[model samples]
Target chain A: MLSKTIKTILTISAVTFFLSACSTTSTPDSATGSSTDGSSGTSGSSATTDGSGKNSVNDGVVAPTATVFYFDFDSSVLRTDSRALLDAHAAALKASPRSVRLEGHADERGTREYNIALGERRAQAVRAYLVSRGVTSPIEVVSYGEESPAVDASNEYAWQQNRRVEIK
Target chain B: MKKVMKFSIQVIVASFLFVSALSHAELTISITKGVDNPIVIGIVPFNYTGGGPLSENVAAIVSDDLERSGQFGPIAPENMLSYPSLPQDVVFRDWRLLGSEYLVIGDISPTASGYQLVYSLFDVVSQKTILFNQPIVVARDGLRDMAHHVSDKVYEAITGIRGAFSTEIIYVEHQKKARNYRLMRADMDGARPKVLVTSKQPLLSPSWSPDGQSVAYVSFESGRPAIYIQNLATGQREKMTNFKGLNSAPSWSPDGKKLALVLSKDGNPEIYTLDIATKRFTRVTKHFGIDTEPRWTADGKGIIFTSNRGGKPQIYSVVLADGYPQRLTFEGDYNARAQLTPDGKSIIMVHRRNKVFHIATQELATGTVRILTTETDLDESPSIAPNGASLIYATKRNGKGILASVSLDAGSKFALPSTSGDVREPSWSPYF
Candidate 1:
């Protein structure tokens, strides 16, 4: 009887941990006015409200923030304006031991696979820059390939806003 | 004045007959709800100038390609009234009388070192030139390739979708005699298949770069399926993303810089992206459940992939930035191996509903869905042509895997029962 009770408790603990790891809260974009910064989240703006409404903000850990790097149309090359942002990310990552993920993106204009590769190149360029800056804490990179949009509007201005790499 | 007026009237009548003939040449492809009707098209022999018998027959190949789509019924050359080489040469009355809805006319002229092909397509009802393509040339043995170029144009202009004819499809032709799997690259019509690399071991997942110059596929030569990218020009190959556990389903990023592949190197089957230039990899999905068959959206902002995370194999999209994933499909119990249309507005995926696997297209914007294929048994791994008008997928016929294509808009569909062996993993190359 005792052993069975202990096994039940252990299984419950493991399940809770697994659930926490995959936990995501989807809040209305209208309610949360905070936009992704491309590196880490600013406290209490949007990432604060958990979708379930129970323990809206993560209790122990801070929400991940991001610093964004923007690009031109049909291009993966880092623009002149993105250099400063990339530099800041490199410095922040250097100061911390936490690993970073650079997400590459593109405006929805070209074919899907081409956009994927372009987004990858954009993230890789950011990763290479960070490595060059001596931040070596496992900078993982992936290309969203125009799947997610930072801005909801579909015009050129919004698309330009969408074509970016967010470091988190 | 009377003689001149008579000649002008004759010329106009001849021109009218020619225009009508051009219109009548088109094969009216009616794809009404996918019962497998191959589009019948006529590729008349092109008139050649200054040629010492051009080595390759460009028109015949185009006709063969259309026929092989199993969705196209190529008009017999013997039935053509006259081989109209140019627009003014066609007799509309004759072709309209013969019941051809679409007609393609092309000619080859000698260039400095090669040859140039100019082609046009006419819709029978419109009686106007519907499609016109710029001239393309090839030197010596390359005229065959120019034929493919013309095929692409005609296929696109008529269908409002890009044509995969100019693109090469790499598939594993399973030969029963030797029990060997041959990795072959064939013209989109399944002709002139040249074995690039073959193995006794099973070869799967042949993928093409956006540039169409290279192919990345999984080869089991090393006991396990390993990803390899082969350049078409020099036949130079580089072994990419071979890790422990499962390494399969290699898909290319649109820019040709990274590969979205399924690897168990980190633990279970999860999606990973490998940079071609840097040889670096980043894990995309962190699911304990199976996450495989990753494909990119046109804009490269996110990837739509197959994951059993929701209890069944369903399509999901993940933003690469922080691995934020959103479920894209919920209608079917099993949906795997999705390919996007050229416009990226819809995803054609294999959906399993009521224990039958069918090819279905879902509008990403409206969430309105319709099944494009209702094949009785398993129909999997659909790849859209570059033009997005039609799709070619693998299905089973006579217990052997064959290729089939269907026009999504026209509802025209056809099957290509392989004369050789079972063909699998058909990936349409990017438009040339």
Candidate 2:
């Protein structure tokens, strides 16, 4: 009984450490510049001048919070904006040394089995990007095809969101 | 405590209704378009002489079956001049006056075991009895089946083609809110629905074995996709593929000895055949591009699949001996999910024209493409009947998935009744 209690405490502390490490390693986005540095005194303001004479408030060193990456219809080519976020995730995986799961999805179009292949292609693209970043953690990839949608609607916006790969 | 009890009662009642719905779900068909000059046939009500009230109106079912074929327009019983049960009672003059080219009469008599049906078909135009009294015996609960049997016989005698009224269809129904998916099997006319399997995750790509004894489908119940074959009679399931990647689109070979499926274990999706007896897989296609949705050719010597090797998805046929894939379709920017007709003369596929997905058929010898569906922009997963007369496919109606059927000539069209949730991936079974 005492050993089980100690194991539970150890698991809690380990999870806390892992989460903290993930937050610290993620890179902040330039578009949604969430300032992580409170010493800059620009937390409430929309715009602020930085050292490089730019109006962006973020230092561009904070961790990224976006894990879901979107793709075009019937294509698996990753967007340019997703590169920096994936790099942050790669950094987190390098620091924590944990297994990652990449779940791929597709919009509700085309034949179902073909969509399964398309989803896997997206997931494989993400896996390749992470691997190229020198991350050694084992990555498992699975594609749900067009079965599970991020949004239940059947519009263009929903389709864009549904064609994505989520990192868990 | 009282509120909890009330909620429990409601839950029990709701679950009971759900089970009942699964078992008794019947697809009501509405004919959108029919043949221009349908042959009119007059069917007299079958005279039933059983111990108690008959459970099913056998003659009505027969009339419905024949009418749904789009080749025969059954005359209503109320309009019939006489109710005939035998050849002697069928007045050729009366049917000719009613503008019916043919007449059908039947009688159901109670037997020691159950019942015996004696039916006859008469050619009103020729003024001769084409089919003599044909008798079929069935148990008490098989009135519907007995009706379908009579319809099949009459249909073949008239159209010279074996009827598919007695066949069955399998489809997947998904309840999005509950995250539940049920694989259902029903009669060809959508009656007596029975659930084959249910899962919390998604189920798709259901294919029937050639013998109609078992079905193969891809299920994600285990948090990942895997192919499974379930016996229709015993409800026993066997996991056919459990590879690290996709194991989907399991198409039974014509001989039923092997299954052609897609597996991505070797870096990307490719077609492979699994020997059922030996449990060995032989890679059929060796391509870096995505080759998937593999369907066996009618001859079973080659496989026709969807591949994006030429910058876009198109139908391709690869012979097992040569391992060389020859492209078959060239007219469409997107053509996938290729299913050959029973004659193997043409390929039926989901084709895109003007960015609208429709079911189209292409002649292999002439490269002539003919589009079949024009009602909806999202029609897909076309499964042809064994007789090659009609095909059923999934289409979206008001954002809800439903099944629709169209004759090969694109003359007759009908939509299956929409269930509570979405229904997709319809697979018409081979003749039982």
Candidate 3:
């Protein structure tokens, strides 16, 4: 029964996505139109030349696609692979000064409150890295502990995926 | 994208069932293990002389309570040779033939405004009345409470220990499919559950006050984690902490005048005590490592918390006067979420051995360790009963979170499975 319900929900979400896409395409000045082509920087630069200047901040800069950074078990130290992506995020945040929220999470192994503290430590680690990178936008950190899991499983792979901080 | 879709589906389903779930929310208790040689007890069906049937089966409730404690085995009513509601009507030979070592008899008589319960507990072998003609009068809706009272009395009379059957418990139930979280209060046996607070965000670390009139917990209802204290009687809530980084793990002191909680506003997660009235925060631990999960000692003279300053998470106690932390657990590499037993001799905590988490108790003085739960790989948040005979904790069964209880001696065990969703973080209330 649960799987069937999930299937129905997936189908409905797909339909809703398609309908919303159609509605967006029908609008004349839909902001999502330029971003959907994956060449937002080029379109934004042309629009800036057209004197709109609203998209000038993002003219030649590509925002980082990676928002989630994984951590080792019970460790807040960032991985070497996450640095390049975080550098891109720092550049983007510096270019456009928008508030950022860092949500930290942990795997379901230790006690919850301890995990909450661990999650906060992970988020703070990321916040410290971003601040050190000269990104000065307002940064907020929240720890979900193990209460919310990206993948609801108990294996090592799931744990690795769940122990992460999302830059939202 | 998939996560967003799942979350939206959860919100829809939760809103759809919100009304029905409120009216009938409860956790069902299932006894998985009992003592090897449980004491045989016979409970006669209480005679009701009221005009109509009573709302609760007093004798049956009492029987279940005793049996669930794992110390007593109640004989089936069909196996009894006679149903006697009075001490004079109990025949020792009949009960002995039925293999009942002790017997309980009770009856309900109608009163002008409510009902009167008269009960007795007898030792079958000695043919002596242990508790004779104990009368309790209650209003119409308090029959279950009255039955629990009878069970408490009988349990105490036989075991030489105070019974916690009449006490209450608070737990958090999370419906992952619906993204709903509810902080619930219920009888110790998982009956009469009522929602104390509900939110779409997560709630954790529910701590009962020393007076049992209010509860302090961490709620993310306002989009960030903060500590809140809610009066159980008035349903009034006060946001106690709105710190910047983290405000979680609120534990009331033994004196109920202050709350020991974790705050990260200063920098790292550190233990701090907040005066209930003055609202002053006194920093207790000054360490760079993560220091959280602060619990008051029985005397309220020190705070026991989990810290990794020594490299791994271990239980530590910090004296209030000197502010020096003493390590408590050395047997395990992982020990967090510690709670002192009522007598303050032993500490119960989530002990991880061989990468599997289980609830274990360690003596504070002798450093002796006893593992209480061995059946499950993940057991956390163990809350001891006021009498310190048993404890309830959250463990996963078949990938679903459920509340389970085990005796301190590891002789008896039972699981309280929620009817709706996953239940965790059970806080056993103090005796009323």
- Misplaced by over 4 Å in model 3 are A1-58, B1-25
Whole-structure CA lDDT of model 2:
0.79
Ranking by TM-score: 3, 2, 1
Return the TM-scores of chain A for each candidate in numbered order: 0.61, 0.63, 0.66
In angstroms, how far off is B267's CA in candidate 2?
A: 0.4
Least lDDT summed over 10 consecutive residues: which range in candidate 3 chain B?
B1-10
Candidate 3 i-RMS: 0.7
Candidate 1 lDDT by residue in tens digits, A1-168: 234423443445334333333423233232223244322232222432221222432333233343676677645555433443444445555545587777777764433333444566577767766666567888766555554557644455666667888777
Q: List the residue pairs that clash in candidate 3.
A: none
Model 1: per-residue Cα lDDT over B1-432, one tens digit each: 011222222322232233223321112111223223444456677889873776666776676555444344556666678898888887766666555667888888988888888888887545777866467878866876887777767766765655667776777777767777877777665656778887777677788789989988877686555789999878999888667545677888878788899776664567888888988888898976667889987877678888767776678888787698888888977677777777888889888778677888999898777887775356777888776767777766666667777767634565655666877667887777
Best of the two (1, 3) by DockQ: 3
TM-score attained by model 2: 0.86
Q: Which candidate number would show the highest DockQ if scored against the true structure?
A: 3
lDDT of 2 by residue, B1-432 (tens): 011222222322332233233333466666666555667777787898776668777777787677668776677666678888988877788887777788989989998877899999998888988889999999978888998999899999999999999999999999787878999998887778888998998899999999999999999999999999999999999999999988889999999999999999999999999998899999998887889999888889999999999989999999998999999999989999999999999989999999889999998999999999998878889999999988999988888888989888887788876565788899999988
How many clashes in each structure? 50, 6, 0
Cα TM-score of candidate 3: 0.86
> Per-prediction DockQ scores?
0.01, 0.57, 0.59
